[model samples]
Target: MPFYSSDSDDHRTPPVKMFGRQRPLHAVFGGGRVADVLLWRNKNLSAAILIGAALIWFLFEVVEYTFLTLLCHISITTMLVVFIWSNGAELFNWSHPKIPEIILSQSAFQEVATTFHVKLNQFLLILYDIACGKDLTLFLLAIASLWILSVIGTYFSSLNLLYFGFVGIAILPVLYERYENHVDYLASKGNRDMKKLYKKFDSKVLNKIPRGPVKEKKFK
Candidate 1:
């Protein structure tokens, strides 16, 4: 009988993650501090973010406040407080409130801009592919997704959707991380079922459909 060393097991590579993810969840979410915040490792920061989002949602949805009105009100209140403080400090010979200077780095701005540019290009490519009718399944999926979104848009205002998205971001990631094994198992099973159904549909219905020679346009 061969004896395996205990240290050898520890040295083995980690098993592949769910949803065909090559990296761990932390790395997939860009790793480091961002992942920590998302996973609620920084509890204080995460709670603060949720509280802020809740306040915004309450202001817009419950209070029926317009964004412009809220902005102006906040600006006026801030200015009034600062104005009073600045003058009162002069009269009492008290120290003025220290306002920290904010500076935006050029490199940070460029990085953000580049990321958006890349994402925008990727979105445009997806739309182009869907429009080109190359993949029937992809085109149908896109159409169905857009139609569902359109229906959802009719029921909820943009602000409501934004708030809901924020709430989902705050909740879903943490829950998923905690129950990742069960979630991944269900997701994989569902995906396999979907593929089987798609294969059947393709063979039964799609194969019978007549097609014309598709003209592929070269993109410059």
Candidate 2:
């Protein structure tokens, strides 16, 4: 008798992995059309999106095209094509071109706005805490993060960073999902090593540092 049955009715819960990501990749990405595109489950759609993004980025960064110019060109081209097609259809007694209706959902916009509002407030609160010197760890971490970003900004233009970010977002998730086990293993090992190093440094250096008596702030 096996400890665990491999029958259709097993219903055994899976062991949780790193970062508490127990759900399938699709579920983790919301299990929707967008998730499908992002995870490359719909390879054609994903490739088209990536290629289109690359083309736009190239035009903006490499060709030095401004947003206003691009918008104007696109609008002019679309108007010319529609006008000619509508007039030609009337003259030729052909069926009218059926333009697809683009409907923007209010709920989707509200959801996005709400999420942004919450995240922005949270970020502001964190910044306030850091500025007030509430936590030394968080303050140092924030400084380090900003300093790193500043260094990166010096080397890369804003457009270059955006393009790189888009490319990474499109590619990295699928790659991670494909080699999730290997990635998790490496990440776990790296995390343990980092913890050990931090502990060693804290004991040897941070623990030896002399501290001055702190003066408590008086509330009015």
Candidate 3:
């Protein structure tokens, strides 16, 4: 009478959680091998990549051709788009929209300008809110990230760096989801170690310091 299967086959234990989520397809990574080490999350991988990128930026004289090379790539992309549009127009018997006309259209320009203006205003408001201490740590970190990016941007093309960042953003969360348990274990271990270090420092260093003059029972 039960709707569900009563056989032992239907009640087998589920696969282990990867990262922090239930097993995703990629989590079937042939356990306990080099593939696990290479594909799964590793803390040192980040540091290694950053050092490598910096070395390549300098060794290849990336600064000299960064913008020039970017322009060449953009030129090629523009040609490909134009080619596709021209062919599509002929095949579909559609009128070719003149680029100059589109650029000069008052309504089109106004709509584009309005959208940009609204977005810029919203961004500025969020920045002002952060400056007012909505989240000082987040604001400071964002500024630091921008400063580092500007320095790196001088030596590397912006598009390549931007694309890398976008790819990391899109991919890292899926990876973490797929290996959730492993990631959480590493994080908890790090937290415990840091807490022990801080406690040791507090006891051995902070406790040795005499109370400063400001704390010496401030006489009225």
Candidate 4:
């Protein structure tokens, strides 16, 4: 007799296209790619919002202050705001992009988290050092300068000068903090081993690349 009679039947069917005519709404909102929108949405929105805010603030300052003071306030606030907004936007962006799901593999995610933690720790350490260092003195100096300027403005009844002076004074510490943070980050990342590796890699690739179109020597 045969080993078995043909009594069994396969019931599985190939997967059918469930929604041939329908499309996901999220695709439309995300411009057809969820990751694309997620990665860049915060940055784009933040830039537009911040730029608009800065322009409005500048106009206000111009109307309420002398041209010189208005210019000073604009210059200082622009730098300070951009530095802060960029970092804040980055952190917000990271958090908003479904961070856990974005890094599906545990090992890969762990590595990224570790790297970020290290950088963050370094940044905080630098900030702590600055706080313990000259931050207090700087704060006092800033307050004194602002108060003096305000008093002068008041004596002259110059609202413009007073307003712009106060704004500029408020921004000084923020600017200093951003600058210090940047310097600290650069210092932390500028490790000897990394520098050597980068240099070696650059030499290997760049030094071997041929220079474009050398001009022939023209003798007079």
Taking every candidate in turn, the Cα RMSD to the unseen true structure, in Å, is: 8.2, 7.8, 15.0, 28.2
lDDT (CA) for every model shown? 0.76, 0.77, 0.57, 0.49
Model 2 spans with C-alpha error above 4 angstroms: 1-18, 90-94, 106-145, 211-220
TM-score of each: 0.69, 0.70, 0.35, 0.18
Give me the overall lDDT of model 2: 0.77
Query: Per-residue lDDT for 98-201 in model 1, tens only?
Result: 88888877775765576557658867987997889886666777899989999999999999998998889888988988877667655655544566688899
Q: Which residue segments of model 1 deviate by more than 4 Å?
A: 1-19, 89-94, 105-139, 208-220
lDDT of 2 by residue, 1-220 (tens): 1122243322242223555567888776556666787799999999999999999998899899999999999999999988898989979997877899988788766655765576588669878978898855556667999999899999999999988999998999899888776766566555455556767978999999999989999999
User: What is residue 104's positional error in candidate 1, in angstroms?
Assistant: 4.0
Candidate 3 residue-wise lDDT, 96-132, digit = tens: 7466543456765665576557658867987788778
Candidate number achieving the greatest TM-score relative to the actual structure: 2
Per-residue lDDT of candidate 4, residues 90-188 (tens digit): 777733222233547776566557655765886687566555655544344456776897787666544456445555534443343345445333333
Error of 1 at 127 (Å): 5.9
Order of candidates by TM-score, top first?
2, 1, 3, 4
**Candidates, ranked, lDDT:** 2, 1, 3, 4
Clashes of each: 0, 0, 9, 2
Answer with 2 or 4, whichever has the higher TM-score. 2
